[model samples]
Target: MNDQLLSARDLKVSFDLPGGRQAQAVAGVNLDIAPGEIVALAGESGCGKSTLARTMLALEDATDGSITFGGKSLPKSTKKLRAFRKQVQLVLQDPTGALNPRHTVYDAVAEGLRIHGIEGSNEYDQVISALSQAGLRPPEQYLNRYPYELSGGQRQRVVIAGALALDPQLIIADEPVASLDASVRGEILALFQRLRDDFGLGALVVTHDLGLAWNIADRIAVMYLGRIVEQGPVEQVLLDPQHPYTRALVSVLPDSPVGDPQVLTGEAPDASQIPSGCRFHPRCPLVASGKAAEAGIEEKCRTQDLAVLDADPRNWQSACHYSAQFGRDEVRGTAEPVADSLG
Candidate 1:
């Protein structure tokens, strides 16, 4: 079997705008996830992180791209989408919205099994197993309870149970803990970690929280303007960012040093109005300071869109022409956090 469970290349997702314009939500991107690996795609809101996740899950049609599972290309037909969904599950961001108000927890979880054609006692057994895995103890006590009776955390667990019911190989959780309480967020994150360790399940968690990435993900991919500008092991990307955009992201952390980290000046460029050359050049503090230009790369920064550049020791990659100029990120406080909160 291929080591990679899921792979996507040149992935692009575009939406039709009001004025006959095209809004490319997911620009050219490529990624791979190994079995049992938990990878976090971190980016600011509207950076197309969720869109990319949806495209990977086959929930959204790729405007220009290809997604492969276990080295086989995903099928375009509706019948095959069901088969694909059986192996690849999705956990949406909002539990309240994702769950049905009228249905009990048992009904919510059993729905997937029913759709997939599992019947009778087998469905009951699967739902119980799923709810138990999702941290809802014993399963019987909460089976009949409605969403209104459950806490925010428990409701989210119910959403997770729905995904777990399918016994999927891969789960794409979009903002899994964003709406949960601070205390509950850690529990849910810990659950993700536990699931990865115990079940050997591969997960692609779409989150805006860099802290969450540091807390659990084996690798982190930093996205800017729909492109993965930098990616590698979590420690390398979080502690020693190379791309200017990644540096700015890491420098703002609560524990990072205050040596005037590269504070970006302007808002992220709209997808429809992406800048020429480097998409991030307008907000790139390094380029804004005229350093890259002074170093004789100014013209390229203004006219050439950067591509992913391979770094040493394999896996680690950055997309900036000036990435070679940076060293390890400065972090004076080395106190390890027991848990991190989403911003």
Candidate 2:
């Protein structure tokens, strides 16, 4: 019996373009989430991280590959799908847009119960319990208040309360704190950590912010151009990135000590017309600056395609053709990798 809470194998999601070309939103991804774990899916806007999240939630059908929840394939029937949904919930990026201005706090939280036909005389109690769990103390005081009556953080908590009302096991939160103030972002992230500790909830937090991942996630998967380029323990992948793209991302961190910040030129390539070789080669700083050639893999990087990642999700892995050369310590002329060298 596989004990993983959720697992995706060779997952691929694509959409048709006007010229009959396909835009590969998610191309051959393998990921797994254990019970009570938090995995941050970090990437830029067009890397397809959001599409992958939607596919995991079953909102978007995968063009290929398999996703299993609690050891079972995604439900096929509408009834079964609805039942499946009760176990997993989604938290959108914007709280104001997610909530109905007309609905009171109590009604918003109770909506899920009403939809699932789980409502009864205890519905009010359930709503209160969810609100309390979401950090709205003395939940009754806010029951009748409308969304416009709350602050940004409070509104987000209301959205969270709505999900908690269903007693879900896993949460797929896309940019959960992107729109909040910096002070409030910590509050929300801490709330997520507390929920995991108190209820054994598993979550996949989707964001482009590596700093956010550092704060709340146990593991990090760095995606680029529709595929995960590097993934490992949050500390390892962030502090000692192995792929050129990952290195560039980590370098730009406000406090990163990896030499000078490296800003890659140009935007991410369109998914519809992916590059021939390593999808990131076109904008890869190493390739464009001839460092890859110094190491003698530039031609291979441009002409030969690298295979999709296939290592254990918990292990340190990178999909780049020459990952060993980009480790921060190696680049800085140290004999040991970053973790050991830094220590």
lDDT of 2 by residue, 1-343 (tens): 2788888889999999897899999988988888899999999998999999999999999999999999899988989999888999999999999999999999999999999999999899999999999999999999999999999999999999999999999999999999999989999999999999999999999999988898899999999988998899988777777787887887777666455678999999999988988999999887888878998989889888877786376588888876754554545333223442222
User: How many clashes show up per model?
Assistant: 0, 0
The residue pairs in collision within model 2 are none
* Worst lDDT 10-window in candidate 2: 334-343
For candidate 2, give the lDDT. Answer: 0.88
Best by TM-score: 2
Give candidate 1's error at residue 118 in angstroms: 0.9
Instruction: Give the C-alpha miss distance for residue 334 in model 1, angstroms.
Output: 16
What TM-score would you give candidate 2 relative to the actual structure? 0.95
Best by lDDT: 2
